[model samples]
Target: MHWIKTLKYYLKSLGPGFIIASVVLGPGSITVSSRIGSEHGYAFLWVILLAAISMVIYTSMGSRFGVSNKDSILQSIAGNYGRWFSAVIGIAAFLAASSFQFGNNLGVGIAMEGITGVDERVWPLIFTPLAIVLLFWAKNLYKLLEKLMMVLVMVMIVAFFFNLVLTKPDVGEIAKGFVPSSFSFDSLDIIAALVGTTFVLHGALYQSYLAQKRGWKVGDIKKGLSDSYTGISLLALISVLIIITSASALYPNGITVNSAADMALQLEALFGSYAKVIFSIGLCSAAFSSLMVNAVMGGGLLADGLGLGSTMDEKMPKIFTTIALLMGMLIAVFFRGNIIYTLILAQASSILAVPLIAIGMFLILNNKKVMGKLKNNLWQNVLAVFGFLLISIMVYFMYGKIITYIQSLS
Candidate 1:
């Protein structure tokens, strides 16, 4: 009975972290990791490890900020910096989320088409209304979302792990891939996208808002940290599994994956039809989870910025979230060309907001007036400085790639 109670308590504590995990493992993750494995054959696997570590550090900071202060992150920024700064962050985050939503909706469509043999474009029409109903009518929106995301995470884990086992990747090469073997300029764009998607600005900032929604106090700081670690660890593990499955099944056969569907086709060739179906199931879970949460993040932040309420129960946030969902579905249904390029472009555009958000988070967390005793220590500050520099470098590379892509188009 004691063990059962403990298990229930632990599951209750996992709400925010698992939601973050679900958001991180979107269709963007599948596309990037699959392409990395198929094109570079696990040589770039180290990037996921780096991204995971960076995510843990920043997410922990966000968790601490949530527990240590009563104000929302944007409110804190407004108090410290100006309201304009807060508004900019909020608007930028909303726009970035909107841009990524195109891919999320596209992912949902692709998964549905693959699994049901229906037209890919029809999925956006079906799922968008379903998502809206859940967002509006779910009595306890946060708990309902947490529960739904938890189930999806489990589905993705089991499906990917099953496929990973079937792939039977070379254990020795997998071990070696962990080491930073070599770097390729061609891989830089995907690397940035991986980092951008994994260590998401909105996702990290929303950690504070989520913790508050869960009613976590400063006393729960340790628990919040544990939850963050657990979520990010799962994210890294699932990502590695994806790369392993793709590397083993596609690389050896010279299969080039241009989309998630391409990856599914390649997996079918290697492990028969069941593998493709399972992978598509995983893809659907990822896409749907992200589609829901991405809209919430965009709409919630924009409402908060506009001096309306930030929580999902508020009128403005719900309206804006619905708008985001519809916008994404429209794009996914109508704009059918060069989605991979669009995904990369949207992911890259998000880098413009990262440094600003990261720097703001660092400043707010370190503000003794805000965090008081919970303010970052010297080592934390050092690591955050390092993270800022890392984001700067990524931004440079991402800008170069976008320009190169544009020149090619012209």
Candidate 2:
């Protein structure tokens, strides 16, 4: 009974971190991690650890800000910098979410097509409306989202772990994957995508807003930190499991996964039809979970940017959320064949917003006026600097890749 009470208390404190984890573990992460595992085996596994550490640091900062203040991070920016700075951050966050929606919709379509044999394009049309309904009509939006994301996280963990067990991966290779190694051009691209997807700026910013929605206060700082750690650690674990599964199952066979369907086929070949179904379910959960959260982030932030209400219940935000979803679905439908490139491009584009958001949050968090005793300590400041440099490196590589892609197109 005592343990049960403790469990209930723990569960009550967890919300924002899981939301960030769910959004980060979306279709983009699945597809990229699977592709990396299939192509490079465990060679780049170190990247996941690096990305997870960065996630914990930045997300903790966001959570601290949320608990330290009564206002949203956007409002804090407005107070410290200027309204224009806040607006820019909000708008940029919205655009980044919109870009990510493309991958989210494509992932949903692929998972549906893989499962039901319907046209992939049709699935997006069906799922988008369902997402809209959940966003606008749910009785308690925050509770619903929290429960839903927790379930999805569980589904991903079990499904991927089952597949990993079946793969019977080499223990020695798995151990070596944790060791840092040199990278090739292609590996560098995958690394950038991994960083972009895992340590998401919008997801980081949304953490503060989410904590506020969950009614956390300065007294709850320790709980918030625990939630952030639990969420990102789960994220890193699931990611590594996917890579291990793919490495054991696909890498050994020289099977390159260009789409979720390709991953399904390979899983079928390695672990029978049941594995394929499980992987598809996990993929759909990932895609759908991300679809809803990304829309919320994009719409909510856009609403805030335009001086509309920032909360999820606001009509303007809901409207913009729908627009973000529809725009992503349209892109996914028209450009189905290029989804691999589309996912990569979308993840890369997120680099544009990372430094801006990170720097703003850093400044705001360090401001004694805003944060009081919670103002970043020396170690937190050091980590923030490291996070900034990490974002800069990702941006540099992403820029080079995008330019190369454009030149190839021309």
Candidate 3:
């Protein structure tokens, strides 16, 4: 009976982390993981392991910050630094959210199009408005978003795990992937993609808000850690499954995965039709779940940064969230130019904002006055410095590629 009560408490405390898992593992992430699996085989599985460790460390920081402070992340920035500091974080978040929102819009539409035989372009028209309606319709936005993300996370696990079981990935090769000697500069670009997609500090920043939204307090740290671990582990596990599935099914055949859809089509060619449907189910879940939460994170941050209001039911947050959805939908529907390039640019800009956000978060968590008893431990501080250096290296690596890509276009 006591164990059952403990289980109920754990279940009740399980919202923010699951949201982090679902929102971070969006279509773009799936595509990146697929490409890594197909091109590099299991050799780079260590990257996901590295990313999961880094994310768990950072998200733990975010969760503590959420419980330790009554203010939003941005509001805390304003108090300690100034309004200008918070504003910078807010605007950057909104721009990045709005930009990547295009992909989510296109993603949901694409997943539907793949299944329903409708043009992907037409599907966003129907779905984006529904997202807006969902924003307005929710009496308590956090509860709704949490429940929705849970279902999506379960969908991804089931759909991708089913395919993974089918692949029968080489147990020995997969084991070798965990050895760091397998890493190489040749795969540095995809390595950055994996890290950027997984060690998403922006999502970490949002974790604080989600915790507070759950009505968490300083005493809830144990439960918060539980949720964080569960969420991050699921994220790493699902990503590994996607990569493993591709490595087994496509890497040996030398099929390059250009998209999530590419992985599905190629899987079907090898494993028959069920592969496509199963993979597509995972894709749809990823896209739709990300579609809603992207706006919530972006708009909520923007409003708080601007000193408008971070609460979703508030007028400003809703307006900003709706704008994010519309921005993505219009670009997804009306853009006649190169789609992938646009997504890359959007994501790149967002990645650029992460260092500032991460540094600010670290400072807050370390502040004795701010965190009190929760201030940074020796291990957390060590990881923060190390993570910073790693991110600096990645940014340099990614920036060079973006420059070369643009130069090629010119």
Show model 1 residue runs off by greater than 4 Å.
1-5, 184-186, 404-410
Q: Higher TM-score: candidate 2 or 3?
A: 2
lDDT of each residue in 239-310, candidate 3, tens digit only: 899989999999999998876677888988988888888888888899888888988888888898899997
Give per-residue CA lDDT, model 2, range 37-106, as digits (tens): 8988998889888888888988998899888788888887887789888888888888888878888988
Candidate 3 to truth, TM: 0.95
**Residue pairs with backbone overlap in model 1:** none
Q: Rank the candidates by lDDT, best first.
A: 1, 2, 3
All candidates: TM-score? 0.96, 0.96, 0.95
**Model 3 regions lying over 4 Å from their true place:** 1-5, 337-349, 407-410
Per-prediction tally of clashes: 0, 0, 0
lDDT of 1 at 236: 86
Residue 311 of candidate 1: its Cα lDDT?
91
Residue 353 in candidate 3, Cα distance off native in Å:
1.3
